[model samples]
Each structure stands twice: as structure tokens, then as C-alpha cells.
Target chain A: MKKFLGAELFFESLYDLGIRTIFGLPGGYVLKIYDVMPSYSKKINHVLTRHEQAATHMADGFSRASGLPGIILCTSGPAATNTITGITTAYSDSVPVLVFTGQVPTPFLGSDAFQEADHIGITRSCTKHNTLVRKTVDLPKAIAEALFISNTGKKGPVLVDMPKDVLISESEYKMPKEVKIKSYSPKVPLKNSEYESFRKVLTASKRPLLIFGKGACSDFNKKLISKFLNKSKLPAMSSIMSLGLIDGTNKFNFGVVGEGGSAVSEDLINKADLIVSVGCDLIKIVPESNLKSKDIVVVNIDKANFNARTKGNMNIHTDSDNFIEKLSAEKGLSFEWEADNLQKLREKYLNSQEKEAKTNKRAGIFKLISNLSPKNSVFCSDFSYEDVILQKFLSVSDFKDSILSGGNGTPGYGFPAAIGATFARPKSKVISISSGINFQFNMQELIVTLEQKIDLTIVVLNEKKNKQKKYSGPDYKSLGESFGVKSHQLSYNDKNFENNFKKFFNHKGTALIEILI
Target chain B: MRHIISILVDNEPGVLARIAGLFTARGFNIESLCVAETEKPSLSRLTLVTSGDEWIIDQIVKRFENMINVIKVEDLSGEDSLERELIIARISTNQKTRSEVLRVADIFRANVVDVGPKSYALELTGNKEKLEAFIEILRPLGLKEISRTGLISLKREKKKITER
Candidate 1:
């Protein structure tokens, strides 16, 4: 008979799943698991984060970069609660993360046991799925299921709450050979009627616009999207989260569309007769209010968004790539009207090329990024006017990777996520386009990047004052003060910040570059 | 249009709540709903009859499909399918109603699975219409209380796979 502790089994399963790192803080309830962590240190790296919130963010960053489910572990009670924000962040962003938390012993559960919190109940809303291990025998299966849930379909975070007693309990555990969740099958093949209807709609429409959302940016479907964009010559704009899905240089590209959208891109979206939203939520930011046009077609993996938003239009529920492929295969489609509009857009928006004009730090930073970015570099940007400025100055080639925060516009997300991206694709150069103030939120994360020897570059826009206040005046400063920023205290001089950053990173075995204008 | 949709979901807590919330948040009307565990312990099947327009139904299906626990969804309105049968027996009989009930049971092909000195039980399996018709007759003949296994379905001939 083979006997093994449940914590060992859980870690073994994680190791088998190719998990290389775990971000977490230790606690009394999870001490046993932490004790066994050293035995597997050679195989897995544990990141001791200052806060559980940061741990979850670290995991999220890892997931965004690697496309693998990010793993996180923490103790019970407040420790577990701290991870809620991170889990919610991952959930909203559709990042795959597996979160593990300790619990008081099952016997002591619901009795106000020390460090006991309703981990499952609290995290249920934030996670795609959650499970509590009641039996020691269920440990392996539960962990496996958590991983499966985190990685499958519209991937998001999943939580497994392990009771301390269950962790210490001995049982003959056999990992489930397969998972058969009958009620939850996510595969939906397009119906024949749906296909015909979509084909007819596509053929009849004179002016068609493609709006790619984050779901279309999956690694599995990039080629299909590229092929479709190449063939259709339809002007397309990605959601902020879907930034790099379509190459900026593509003839049909209209750039990102929203509040921070380019003037030309917004103009094209407003003029589109038939708007095709692929895997986008059709939310307020990408406002339907602006789309008074009735002829909108939404193609999405989620039927609810499509159906809800399909009042005066056609809604197609299918995988983004599959729908694009099906559309590409249809015969007798002429887009003469679309071609005319594309040319008009090109003449209006594409004609302005100002590489020689460097008037401000925003423009300078943008030019620097465009000039120095390697063929396959990944750019992560903070939510600043710099994003808009960079859009104007930098022309992303077909090969570079661009990751944006999208719906979850959390500040300080860029630097850590960039670090995770570097870890995910070590061969690719990873850079963060940071706003000066947003950098203050997760400054501690830079220590992790340095310690891990991750190759990531942080390009901070060193504006001595809040430009929004400087330009928009006292009103903006009032709002900034209300939001907890002391506008008066915001100032910086040219003080060899690059070398200082390099020295800080040098101790941790990483590289840093700071550009001051 | 009110369409009958069958959904397969993981047998976990809060899944039903999430599904219901999704529908309610959209202000869609769910006329009737039935959910229960199937042969598989870890999976549950939900049958919902909803009245909405084409766009609304499409949205409901699309949103439901996006949920991680939802394995599959089927709209049976346009298919050849077999609906499930639920039977309940309420008898008030010492000897007189017993024979009458037995004669009726024999005629309707229902089985008397339970029996007591004053009461007897009969099990019937059929479509909702047939079951309702039988219940109407039983009601007048002193039917007691009834239990029903809502609606379960399988395609009549071949399995039709619908894609998203």
C-alpha cells in the first residue's frame, strides 16, 4: 500500500501540471504545506509576497505572460480574504489562475475556529468555480478539478479550500482519471441555419467593420484571425485588451476604439454600417450608445452577450476563430463600399506620419518605444495619455506582442504583468510603459522581478507634475486630491534615475532602463 | 417566442444561482425550469422554458454557453425528441377503489409499486400530456397527493450536436 500525506499529493499534482512558481504568504493553517514546499523547491519556486493581494496579482501576471494557469497559495481567514481582489481581477480579465487557501480543521469548522473563514463562500463570486475538501480522499481530485476549471473554456480563477485537518489526514488517494461534469459542457457547434443566416448577412452588407475582443486574442486562434483580416480587407479595431490581435500596419486596421481611441479610429467606428463585435462585451466603454446604427452583428463565444446585444441585429454564437473561418469561406461576397471607406480612412488617418517632430515627453517616449522595440517585444502600458500618445507615434509591426489591461483598468498592473510576461517568454523582450504615479502602487513588485533575474524594462514617464492638472487646471487637481494623490508633492528632477534603477535591479539579477525627457 | 432549452451543468453549488442571476439580470422571462442530477453524480441537467424574441433567446444561449460549468445546451423546439415521464399515485381504497384503480391501471399500463391496507400506489411513465390526462381522471376518483419527475429528454433517433 502506498501512503502519502494529502499536502504532498496536492503539491505533486501541481508539479505534474508544469507549475513552476507559486505566489503566497505563509500562515498557521498552511504551515504544513509550507514545510513540505522546501522538499520540492528544486522543482518549484515559491514567491513570499508582502501581501496576499500582490501574490494574486503576481500569479495573474504570470498567467498573462505564459498563457498557463497562474498558481497562488495562502493561509486562512484574512489572508484568504486579501486574495479576493486579485481573484476578482483575474476573473474579470479572464486570466487562468488556480488559488489555494488553508482552512481550520473540518471538526472545528463553523465553530469560530481560530483563523477560520468561509473561504469557499467568500470567493464563490470572484472565482469561476470553488470547492471545499471534506474528505481526504477527495484531495487529488479536487486539486485536479481546480486546475481543469482554471484552464478550460473562458478561462478564469478557481479556488480549492483545504481544511488543515484534511491536509494532515492520511488516506489512499487515487487521482481521478477523468472529469465528467455532465451539466457543464462548453462546446457548441454552429448550427446550419445560423451559418446560412450569417453568410447571407455578410454577403448583403456593403460596409462591414470587425471589432476584435480579448477572447479572439487566444494563442490557439491567432492564425485564423490573421488569415481572416488578410482576406477580408475589413477595417477592424480591437478592444484595449485585444490590442495586439491585429497588426497596426495591416491595411484594414483602424486601431483601438474607446474614450482614449485615436480620432480617426473613432470616426471610422461611428461611420460603420455593419459593426461585427467578436468576443467583446459591448459594454459602456465600448459604448453601444455611440452605435445608433441598427445593423450590428455580434460574434461571440458567450451566447448571453450576443443575444442580449442583438436587439436590432444578428447574433452569432461561435468560437471567434471558427466564425471568422466560416465567414472567410463564404462565396460571392463583395465589399466595394467597405473598400471605399477604408481608402477614405487611410487618407484621413494613415496619411499623418510625424517621426521627426518631437515636441513633448509623451511623444518622445512613444518615438523611443517605436525605435527601440525589437521584432517580438511585448509592450505593457499603464493607463495614461501615454497610451494614446504611443498609439500615435509607435507603429507596431506584425510580429511584436502587445498586451493591454482592457476592462480591468487596475493601476500598477503593468509592471508586474510585464515581469510575468518576461518569465513566460524569456526570449522576447518585455517592457512596461509606466505612468509616474501608477508606478507607486506596486513598486515593491520590482523587487520580485529583480530577485528572479527576469529580463524586464520599465520606462517611466517622469512628468514632474500631473499633466491632467497642469492642462485641465484646478478641477483636475481637486479630483486628484480626492483620489489620494497629493498633487503638490508630485515632482522629480533628472537624477540618473536609470543608474539608480539599474543598481536596485542589479542586486536581484535583472536589468532596468529609465528614459527621462 | 418561448423556447424550451436543456442545459447540462456541473453539479456544484451556486451554479444554478449564477444561471438564474444571468437570466434575471438581462430581464428575460423564464416560464418554467427543472434541474436535477442525472446518471452522472457530478453533473446536473437544467430544462428551462423561456419566452423571448430571437435576439433574446440567442443572448440567453450565448451567455449560458460562456459559463464554465455549463457543458452543453440544446434547444428541443426544432427536433424529434422524447420527453420524460413522472408518475404519482394517491389512492383511498380499502377494496372498492382498489379494484377500480387496478382495472384503470391495467388499461393505462401503470404499475402498482406500493400498496397499503387502505391505500395503493401506481407508477406511470409517459409524456406530459398523457400523464396530465390520466391525472385528470384520477383526480375525480379520489386521488391523494402526487410526486412528479419533471421533464427529461433524449433525441428520438440520432444525436444532434448544436454548435456555438
Candidate 2:
């Protein structure tokens, strides 16, 4: 076997794993990896982000958009700490992200050397798994294992802390043929008995409901799930994190089922006799008061997720994709759900929403944006009053079509995530919606969007005289101009609103539209 | 309601702290814990005692299995298993009570490890109930400083016996 430096193996492993792009900021300890960047520059494209946090958010967005483990690289100490919020965000949402942080030399690990931090200890609770590589030979195995742990089962962030000396040390390079952890198994085999039980309950119910949670929020599973729901004619609802699993036009599809969910959807959840929650924990799905009387079946890849809140009549230990495929393949499995009452309820709810939009300026602006969006456009929302408003009116055609910060609810996740979505789906229009105050959290990333020349449109809702006084300041148009991005300010109710909005929305490159309500 | 969870994990630095951190993060308390190297030197066995309902115990076991370094986890609660605890206690004694303490120790099969002018140090090993009984008997005899090696356990082997 030929000998290679740890840094060489690091980049080689990433290249072999099909990672074309990475986001990070170079610092003292991580200079070794950057030093070797020139040799393999063609294979890997590194985006030098303004801050480690933005880099992590970009990776998270990239992962959610591309369905691949997002990769983030940074140095030790403060740089590593900067990525905590982003890492926690990925952890909460169960997004698969590979985080590599450079550490001080192994000898200086415990001495509190400059730029040194105990990455493993600090990230233990937030990450699915983490390792501190002490030997150069262990680098390849660690990288492969971290990727595996992050992208499989209950997908979450995984961190690999690399000491400077180990990165520079030479070792015989042998690609690990197969990486397996004796204890970590992401897939639980589907047992025939459990499947039969699920089928029996699914087929026998008068009113059955299907709920899609983050566990079922995957690109590959979307078509299979939609086909299953349509064929069975089963009423379906989604959690906010998985808004787009069932197309908005699907007659059986109900909007969200959690906080800020529609009243009609909540009523449907209460009326349904049998609820097969795929990849959802069912928290808040069934009201605590009605939990005992509720009959639920939960299908999840990880048994740990099936806790007291998720305890059901039957728990199937299988992933969403596998469960959907198996359920769809079995012939003669049909649900006798009545769609007439559900249709009437949905129509009523939608009409009420339309009436509200006529009076509520925020709702009206969101409705206009939702109507004007092109087919297959991706919308990333930051945490604000507008985030919930957008979910209420926006129609999602596919999985990941509407990317909200599901788990961590991190502020300022919209813009960088949109940038990441643009890279992941270059052919599709990527739009970010945020309030004026929340957009300022990571507004500095506008320069990155301009530099990359990514095709993205950002809409910042500048609601004046807001109920929350502190969150009602800042001129986003001026800030966008400072970053050299095309900026426009317009009112949602302007006479030529449609024309002005389309001008920026259809722009070929990055644009920021500040909608004053 | 009490559970004894035995886990086998890779022996490495910070492994213990990680386990403790998991319990603390979930707002669960570890009542008593014992850890030491097993026959396989690279792996360590950790036995922790806790009390909760069945659901809480199930959650704890699942959470441990979710951890990467943990090799195996078995809840020995209500299982066919053997449990042992070791306790060393020093009891304040006088000439009138010294012999009485020794007599009680002899009954409990405990050894008088040290005999000082003011106190008698007794070493005992038994199941939880037996250890508790011994401590109760010694408390009135003026029990002083005490140290205990918390509960350690292993599953019992299933072996059949032939008639002699």
C-alpha cells in the first residue's frame, strides 16, 4: 500500500464518498488541510464562509436539499464553538452533517494550548457520535465511520476532531472496504408479523389517517408515499417539518398537525380511528387528554424514538421508505376512509384563510408570494411571525419544497440555507423568506451569495409598528445594497405589486426584495 | 421499580463521564454505579442502579443502546441474575460493646478487618438485603465512617444437573 498523509486521506475519502462541495473557514490548526487544498482543488470545492456558524448552516441546508450528508470543516476552540448552534440545529432536525474540526497536537491536547478545545466532550449531547483521532492511521476509518453514523438511521450531525500532528503524519493508506459498528445499526429488519398487524389495523378502520413527520421527510420516499396515500385514498397530514411530503393539491392531504396547524386538521386527527404515523414520534399529534382513547401505529427506523409520547398499539421497526414500499406493494390493502366530510372541512378552512388574508396584511403578503412562486421553487423560512404565515398559505409540491428550521428553530437559517439549496438545485429557483429583524442575524452572508453568483431571491417582511417593538427596525434594502446585491423596496398592496415582485423574483442572479406591510 | 442496567462499553477516556452526562442530560439520576474492566481488557462493564416505572426504564435502555461506544446493554432488573455489594464500615466501640460487635459480625459472616482503640472496622459482602440488615445491626453499635462499593451484577448461567 502506498503511504499518504492524513490530510491526503481525508480529502480522498471525502472525494470517494461523492462530496463535491464543502463549507468552512480556515484557521491556525486547520491550516494543514487548507495547505493541501491546491492539489485536489478540482475534486473538492470549498466555500470560505464568513463565519463558522454560517458555514454549518450552509452545510445543513445543503444536506437537507441534496439528501447527502453536509460537510463542514473548521479549526479548534472558538471556531469549533461557533458551529454549536448550527450543529445543534442539524441535530434537532436530524439532518445528516459531517463536522470536521482541527484540534491542537495530541501532545498539547490536555495542556490548554492556544486554539484547543475538547470537541468530543462539548459536542457529546448534540451529536449522534463523535471521535478524536489520536493516530494518523485512524483518520480514514474515523472519517468513514463519522459519515456512516451521520447519514444513516436517525440521521444527525457527527464530528471528527483531528489534531494537527495527526493530519501531517504519514501512514499507509488503505480504504476501509466496509465500515460497521457492532452496536450502531441504522436499519431494523421488517418482520412479517408486525407488517401483518399494521396492515390489519390499516385496512379495518372506518376512518384512518396517515401522518408524515421528519422521519418520512426524504426525497426518495416522497413518490412512494404519495402513491401509497393516493392508492389507499387515506387522509394524510404532515408535521411542520414535513410539510411537502403530500402535495398540497392531493384531495386527501391535510396541512400541518402541530402548533400553528389548521383547526380542521386537528379535528381530523381527533376523529380518525387508526393513525399510522410514519417516522413521527406523535408528540402533540394526539392531545394529551385524548391519548388514552387514541389508537396509533408508529413506524420508525430507530426504536429509541418510540417512547412514552410515541407509544402505540403496534410499533414497526422499519424506515419510512421501506415501510411505504412494503405497504404499497401488498395488493388488496385498502382503507375505507370517507373523503366527503374531509373535503367540506378543508374547503371551509381554506375559505376562512382567504377571508383573513383580505384583512391581515402579513397574511396577504404571504398569500401573494405563495401564488406567484414558480413550480418546484424551494422556500427556506427563518423563525419569525412570517414563517408560520408562509406555511399557512404556501403550497408545497414535493418533499423539501418548503424547508423550515424544523428542530432547532434557529434564527437566520433562511438565507444561507437558500444559498445551499441553490447550489444543490441549481436549475430550480431558491427563495428565502424572513422578517426584517431575523434576517439581520446572518445578513453578512449576502456577500457570499453575491460572490458565488447563485440564483436566489430573498424576501424580507418589514412589518412596521409590530406588536413586538424590538423586532420592528432595520432597513433591509440599504443593507442589501451595501453587500452589492440588487435591492428593491415595495408594499404588498401596491397597485403594481405583481409586476414589481416578478421583476426581482425572475432575476437571473441574487436579489433581495423588502416587502413593507 | 428499581432497575440494574449492565452495560459493556469500549474502555476509553471520558467514557464514564459521557454515560453520566447522558443521565444528567435526560434529568435522570444514577442512584449507584459500579464500573471496572471485565475479562476482555479493552471493554469495561458498568452497572448502574436506578428506580423508575417500566416506561422510564425502557427509555433509559434505549438511550444507552443509541450511544456509539456502548457495546451491549442489559437491564438485570427482575432477571435471573446474581447481585453483590461490598461494604466497609467503622463502628465506634467500647470495652462493653466490642465483644457484642464481634458476635454480630460472626453471625453475619463479616470479618473484623481492623480493631482500633476507639472503633472496629468490619468488611462485609452480600446481596442488598443482607448488607442492609448488617448495617442496621451495626448502626446502634455506633457506626461511624463507611464506604461502599455499589451493586455489581451478572446474569446467572443455565446449567442442568444430573442425579448423583
lDDT for each residue of candidate 2 in B1-164, tens digit (9 for 90 to 100) = 89999988888887788788877876888889999998878888999998877886787788787787888888888889899999999999999999999999999999999988999999999999999999999999999988999999988886211111
User: Which ranges in model 1 have alpha carbons more than 4 Å from their true place?
Assistant: A307-310, A330-332, A338-341, A351-360, A384-400, A462-517, B1-164
Candidate 1, residues A211-296, lDDT tens digits: the string is 87777776655666666667767677777666667777677777666766544766766676777887887655466676776477
Which CAPRI quality tier does the interface of model 1 achieve? acceptable
Q: Indicate the residue-level lDDT of B64 in model 1.
A: 71
Cα lDDT of model 1 by residue, B6-71, tens digit: 888878777888788767777887766789887777878888777777766776676676676777
Q: After superposition, how far is residue B4 of candidate 2 from its true place, in Å?
A: 1.6
Candidate 1, residue A374: CA error in Å? 2.3
- CAPRI quality of model 2: acceptable
Model 1 chain A: worst 10 consecutive residues (lDDT sum): A483-492
Q: What is the lDDT of residue A268 in candidate 1?
A: 69
Tens digits of per-residue lDDT, candidate 2, A146-184, equal 999999888999999999999999998766889887667
